[model samples]
Target: MLTYRQTPPIPALGGIVARFSQRRCREAQRHVPAFDLPARLDRFIEFYLGEPVRVGTGAESPRAVPEVVLVAPHTRPGKRLQMLGDVDTFTIHFEPTGPHRLFGLPLQGLADHALAAPDALGTAVLRLRDRLARAPDFDARVACATAWLGERLAAARPADGLDALVAARITPGMGPAAATDNGRVALWARQLGWSERHLHRRFIERTGLPPSLHGRLLRFQSLMQAHARAPASPLTQLALEAGYFDQSHCIRDCRAFTGQPPGAFLAAWPDLGRP
Candidate 1:
């Protein structure tokens, strides 16, 4: 059986964090093919405590993943994951600009690649990993990780308000007045009192993708959530409600993000994404 737990970060780190989640499974589910959809908006930093996990970008096959991995925001799918043996994983789901705010790294550089945590943060991440591994219980693990994050935040430079502002706008419905207008980065720029090019540069630097692409991905996420909640809902209705131009537009977006046509997508993974 698979069990999962989710907890919010400390209030001080709330701006950069979405939540921390842990998942464990003593035996892999045989009936369902275990996999994960492409991450959108929030980046995922994962810590594996069991056998090496397998991940692949295509239907061809999967390769072993390292102990620690940071998955950047993504749209084009084909990313699949399979857990082996008994599994225990702790993950950090970061807000859109959290990668920049927390790690002090260029978000674009980390895009779509899962580099070793040690490689990304040198000894600090490795030290944290060791501490987490040594933790006596789940609560201890959470305490250790968040304490490490607090120290990192203390040492790291502060984020520009603009980065937070732009990242905030990329979410589903929480930002400036004009945030609801899809694909209108220029209008958002005007609303923020900044030039479009300037806003685009900051967005690429802090969130790894341009504003338009991020917005589209968020829209796609909405559709996926909608489908999960009400699988019987009409496709056209879900598409239009989620901001797709039409059913075809939704299908095209689904294909681009999941590498599967809408029907095939729903059929292949009725549960949609890994927990």
Candidate 2:
């Protein structure tokens, strides 16, 4: 079994969320309840010194990731961040932006550049684990960790920026992709003056997934949302609004991504993956 404890404090210059997880042998079959994590995240700082956790026995299999990008427990601070595959259970989150903060400049640009440059950010993060481990008190730990992050971020702000675009064809009421706007994505990227490759690269750097995959994830989320609002809605209608043309098309993608059919999944987790 797996258990988690979380202590979330007020948002600081950079938001901090701490989660402690304890789990026995991992079961890839285990499905973590669905949850919508915030859209923007700087990076996750994880320090776990207990039992080892494993994912995808063969390294390319669909291991239990957190249904999203996660910083795995065993990945120490200095190593390149390991993509936490769908974890049987794990908890860690960091959001650099909150309602208020004193630093007015963008830091993700710097962090990304630092992280990509010979893993400098990784090295600093590795030191964080050691610093926190030696901290003598609770207040000291938080203060020290926050300070460690602030210094690296202050110097490394990158020249580039992360951006958000209002997706034209994927909005709440947008019709099927085949009907409403088949090339909207290409047009939007062109309008932003970014090539597909550039867009995909930045997205992957920040989101841990390519834009193509991100599109699919968003579509899946839309389907799940529409279903929750009208449980009895026909599969055809659900598919159309969610950007799929036919029921079979939607089912195929759903099973491939979530490993479950829509109806059976809803039956088991009635509250949209929440408790």
Candidate 3:
């Protein structure tokens, strides 16, 4: 058993941030708990200090990033620390960003270096949570965590077009205006200059979901994000911008993917993301 507690949120440029404290490392669950978390809530800056835990983020299942993850601090089972930030909630790290190096390689790639162990990444995470136990202020703890992540991210890939595409697919902003029903996956593919197959391949490899599904979900997110910005946003417009033909179409997609109506879901989780 473990104790899980969330600190008050600290606002960032486009997201709300928080630090979590836990007693006893939590076990990986069958699924990463699903929450219509406030879209303002982005990723986190995790600092490992004591104990140990594992984390995975995917669509109702744990999966690996087809690309690579960079772990910082040269993770050592009980010694060096671990950390990350701005992480997409849906993304699960199969590898640490660094122990000292950049380019976030996979476990197999780092088998030779020090700060390696079968459970190095996950184990180091739990240690991070433990260290938070002694944190005097939430901001202080969060600052440490954020800086670590920033450093690691700086060392990693340059947010290449592929990464940007994934981000665009994962998180999109919506306008208050209604979207046209004419939207289609092919249309988006053309806009990105990618063949449907190429886009789908990279999206699935990076995200766990296919391009079409991602587009659907993100459309929902966009509409809702727009609504959050402007309460008077026309509902029909929301659906259209999100790629639905009409409000009814948006409702159907919501029910199919989110098991709730767009209206109710939005009402239930205010400021929470469309996903």
Q: Backbone clashes per model, in order?
A: 0, 11, 21
**Which predicted model would earn the best TM-score?**
1
Model 3, 88-180: lDDT tens digits are 121112211122223233323332133322244445444444444456655455554545344445455443454544444333344212222
lDDT of 1 at 145: 83
Q: What TM-score, computed on C-alpha atoms, does each candidate reach?
A: 0.86, 0.46, 0.48
Candidate 2 per-residue lDDT, tens place, 1-275, comes to 23333344334332323222322223312534322221222235345323223234222432322222323112111211222323232223443221012223223234212122114233555566566657664455566655754564444433223332422323346553432232655665687787866765655554444445445555665777777777788878877777776788778766655456766654554341211
Clashing pairs in 1: none
Q: Please rank every candidate by lDDT, starting with the best.
A: 1, 2, 3
Q: lDDT for model 1, please.
A: 0.73
Task: Estimate the overall C-alpha local distance difference test score of candidate 2.
Answer: 0.43
* C-alpha lDDT of residue 112 in model 2: 19
lDDT of 1 by residue, 185-253 (tens): 766677779888888887888888876677677777777777777778888877866777668877877
Backbone clashes in candidate 2 total 11
Off by over 4 Å in 1: 29-36, 170-183, 191-193, 270-275
Report how far off residue 16 is in candidate 3 (Å).
16
